[model samples]
Target: MAYGLSEEEAVSSISLSPCEIMGIEKDYGSIEKGKKASFFVSKGNALDMMTNQVTLISIDGVVQSTSNFQYELYLKYRKKDTTN
Candidate 1:
């Protein structure tokens, strides 16, 4: 069996390999020809950046806003709590 389900599956149960998903098996899901840039780099686990802080995030070559919704709310309440 070329595929099954396990921790190594990496969320492939409903789909083909990353190369197939992106439709660039020969040029993408790796470094090669005219492949649009994708993916991200985080200070720690990439997923953690969603809850933690993200130094930077670029999607489709455009940088994302650094303003974090949760962090902003925390700051808003933290200031209120301290003042109170």
Candidate 2:
């Protein structure tokens, strides 16, 4: 089997089907937030997964800084142990 469908086709399929079925036709298939934060952020090209990087990740308005966040988290935890 072929590995993938054309990008245009793939986007069209999802944009028309599930969004309509679930009655989220106005917001879910696009960038409207009140519907859901379920979408991808692409850099340069949408399908270019290798070079496309996620700069930030947020959930329910709680921001997560992917860049130094991991290191910061480790430091926070380490400090807690040291102060005990």
Candidate 3:
């Protein structure tokens, strides 16, 4: 991203660099049929997604909640503390 790589190039970097850098291309950094489906889902294209939040996230195909703990805490305490 610092080098101004396009969104596609950036995406491919994450998917391929790990394999090349760590020498683990055989097992990680890809979505093979037998490998785990550790990926996330976004509503828009990579660059455009800056304004769009991630809608779904998963690890090894296990869906994870996107709840923001800090935001929740703020909401929980904002009413209690009228200092804002």
Q: Judged by lDDT, which candidate is best?
A: 3
Q: Identify the runs in model 1 with alpha carbons over 4 angstroms from their true place.
A: 1-16, 22-28, 31-33, 47-53, 81-84
1-84 in candidate 2: lDDT tens per residue?
Answer: 125777776675656568888987775665565765555444565456567677656543456656587878888887674553
The reply for model 2, stretches above 4 Å from the true place, is 1-4, 13-16, 31-40, 56-84
Whole-model lDDT per candidate:
0.55, 0.63, 0.75
> Candidates ranked by lDDT, best first?
3, 2, 1
| Model 3 agreement with the true structure over 1-84: per-residue lDDT tens digits | 547987768877878686679887666677787777777777776446475567888787899988898979988987795665
* Model 1 lDDT at residue 66: 74
Q: Per-residue lDDT of 1-84 in model 1, one digit per residue for the tens? A: 134446346434322376787776654354345764544555754333355455775655677777779989988887765552
1 against 2, candidate with superior lDDT: 2
Assess the local accuracy of residue 62 in candidate 1 as a C-alpha lDDT between 0 and 100: 78
- TM-scores of the candidates in the order shown: 0.47, 0.40, 0.63
Q: Which one is best on TM-score?
A: 3
Candidate ranking under TM-score, highest first, comes to: 3, 1, 2
In model 1, residue pairs whose N, Cα or C atoms come closer than 3 Å (at least 3 residues apart or on different chains), thus clashing, are none
Q: For each candidate, how many residue pairs have backbone atoms clashing (under 3 Å)?
A: 0, 0, 0
